[model samples]
Target chain A: MDKRKDAGSWNRHKIQAVWALLTNSYLIGFAQGRIYKGSLKNLCLPGLSCYSCPGAVGSCPIGAMQAVIGSWNFKFPFYVAGFLLFAGALMGRFVCGYLCPFGLFQDLLHKIPFPKKIKTFPADALLRKLKYVILAVFVVLLPMVVVDILGQGAPYFCKLICPAGTLEGGLPLVLLNESMRSAIGWLYVWKNALLLLTIVASVLIYRPFCKYICPLGAVYSAFNSVAVFRYQLDQEACIGCGACAASCEMQVDLIKHINSPECIRCGACKRACPVGAIHFRQAGKSRQSNTTGL
Target chain B: MKRQLQSSKAGILLALAGLLMAGVGMHRGEMSTVFEKAVKICMECIGIG
Candidate 1:
């Protein structure tokens, strides 16, 4: 097979793995009478899979962070913080590219037939900053300072904003269990509405939430420079055509900075590179042929 | 053979983690207990329930 075809097949496999992780609701039944109390609680998966999801086998780091921040007894979740650091160091925002169920959902939505595509604008530069502000205020500081002091803690972002929680955890349980539906109120209605709006927006736009919001993406992005999986650029390669930048929806100028925070390691830039300059390097291993220069 | 072994190991580890999380999440009285605690906390904070 041609090298390009081989790369495409590998990408397809990765995409399939992502799909399985996202839609593993049936695994909930296997969890019945199986799990125990004392287990590994720290340094979990990078994506925002809800711990409350019946099929979820690991702790949701965001949920864990909220719980720790909300708790009056605990000072802060050093364990979760360390975990995010570890995950970010290992994979960078590849979690956003290959792991996040919500990201997959958005990608699927974008595949729908839409006349006009949501083009990136100069205002997006300012809007992207909103996610970091949210991470600092809502995800980190609010629960720790305000809620904990008041002896109340809630996953504020998940409650008010996260359509992932509604779509992945809320909708499934409600559909399966009638009791949950009866308990639903205005908040549930609001979350469901938000999910609907996000779905519609995702179809029209290219991952608007991942681009603008999502504190997790913000966290992973900060570690892009020093991550284990690093993107290398061959400066020796001739021809500085602007093809890679044009192909990259993330808007990263690959020639200038291969490790830009905006880069999710989606390989689109690599695929667009004509001179085979951009590539993914894992540790000190031999550089393998990837999607670069397709 | 080495690659196959590595793949199997990964599968086993994931399965074990899944079992452990589910078990802790759904022990006879504990599941409802955790949910109640989480909901009560959410209700007081958000003023919903």
Candidate 2:
């Protein structure tokens, strides 16, 4: 009945689901506005679903929030904010692990048969601060402050750096639409090239963007401590083998705190624990006695 | 069997939500002539108008 024995099946199912969601061209087409009025609309999803995707049925909360706050007549977007908070509270970074189409894309790119693996440098404390700075400046304050002053606001992250927007929204549509191809300028080519480079780098690096960047990850991480469906470490059972930390791609020191914000609950640590020292339960689940495993 | 049933129910609920949203988006014009309002809502939601 140990969950670790069946961990392979769980990981496989999660990976398969990710592929299904990402490669569903019909869904992509719907999001891109091809099936609709040929205008970009918002989806109410918590993650960054590109409004430009033809198959997207709801608005991306991140994009929607930016558009609302950047508007000349500023009014609070209660629906979008409420939806994001609700989703974040319920699932935490489980959304990052399983639901995000963009995250799925990054995972696939990381699966390429590369000779080397990029390990995290935990000693480099400055590198860890980058995502928080990005979240505070680019994701939150900049959009509200700079865009309001300029009288025109853009999805700054998407326009400048987000390889996700290029991969999920731009490249596919441009290939399909002839007019779009003609309208493509130097900027479009530059963005596409950046996306291509990231894809190639991901093979060598384990989620470079998620580790060092990704404002959304920064936000979701803050809630990981209290999120429902959290990981619990049986301290007495832990032999301090460090196997969990060794296997962790997210670079979490699970023995210290399995529910650390950096821990994506990817269950790598749970599976890696030789002594079955780790288990997952809902946040409010009664704490059980911690018994050491032989 | 019970676990399988619960998973199936969860899957169904997610699928239904996705379908309902897609349907509503498709008939957006019929639902509301609130393009400007929707844009405004989206702008505030995203912090870029």
Candidate 3:
């Protein structure tokens, strides 16, 4: 392993590590088994953390969108929509690589030595599109179409499908609060089952949730090709070594699809490049940064 | 530089649009609405009911 490549991975991992703590640092809320009621709850984190999580000071954007869209008024989730566009424009799926607690969860699970590490398969590309379906149906259409007597909609994604809510928020709350435990029913049981599936799948595959299920990642991926900061391939300096593609778990064809929506901007290719060909170009910066090879 | 400008154009427009929409949401008191809902006053928001 090249020390330079190792350092880059380390820096990213370090940010992921600190981010996990900072995002869920409302310690007293966890001890008491109560959700944080602070004003910070109004802001949406780029990650898919559960607002119901006792320690979550900020709301998850997906949940926030559903909440607003599902409200009786059925207004557009302007705030949440804005935030997603804002985040997408700035970083694309870089958030998936470095910021999301759920992404961190899956990354850790994938590291737990398994019989096989499945990067992708025949149905991988098709399966990857599932997140967009989930975003369209569970997050958007279902909430709007399926309404109650009062015209309010349910947070369908959170209640029915979100392992983030189940794992981060539901599990901890149920464990600590006796009252919540007593009230646990079929919905809780169903969510826990989904959470269990996600955990098991993570061990066998890499970032399975990000690849297939996370609606937030789906949103960010839309902007990946044109995000303000993105990877660039210098055709002039290229040797076509294929190392970058070989190293990429996402299997992105580095030259043809340098900034494809599927690319998570994980820098795995950048690390794998033996030649000084790949670099990150910021929107307004005169020079591309970190153009040197490992 | 021309290529760079072309690429950055979409992103800059998107950022500005996001800011404008967020401003509208703020003016409409939607942030407070998010707060109220995140507080989880009703069980149905989380599907317990």
Best by DockQ: 3
Candidate 3 lDDT (Cα, whole model)?
Answer: 0.82
Evaluated at residue B47, the lDDT of candidate 1 is: 15
Error of 2 at A28 (Å): 8.1
Candidate 3 RMSD computed on C-alpha atoms after optimal superposition onto the true structure: 2.2
DockQ of each: 0.05, 0.06, 0.60
Lowest summed lDDT window (length 10), candidate 2 chain A = A285-294
Model 1 residue A179 CA deviation (Å) reads 1.8
The lDDT of each candidate is 0.64, 0.58, 0.82
Report the C-alpha displacement of residue A112, candidate 1, in angstroms.
1.3
Report the C-alpha lDDT of model 3 over A67-136, residue by residue, as the tens digit.
8888886469888898889889888888888889888888778878987888778999899999999999
- Candidate 1: segments with Cα more than 4 A from true spot: A1-43, A148-150, A284-286, A291-294, B1-49
Fraction of true contacts reproduced, model 2? Answer: 0.01
Model 2, A1-294: lDDT tens digits are 245524543564466465446433346454443522323343355565565555554555566655555555543444445445556555567767766677666777777677777775555456766888876666566666776455645556656666766665576666666766676776676777777787776787777777667777777777665555456677788999999898777778888877687776566666677877777655334233121110
Docking class of 3: medium
- At residue A179, give the lDDT of candidate 3: 81
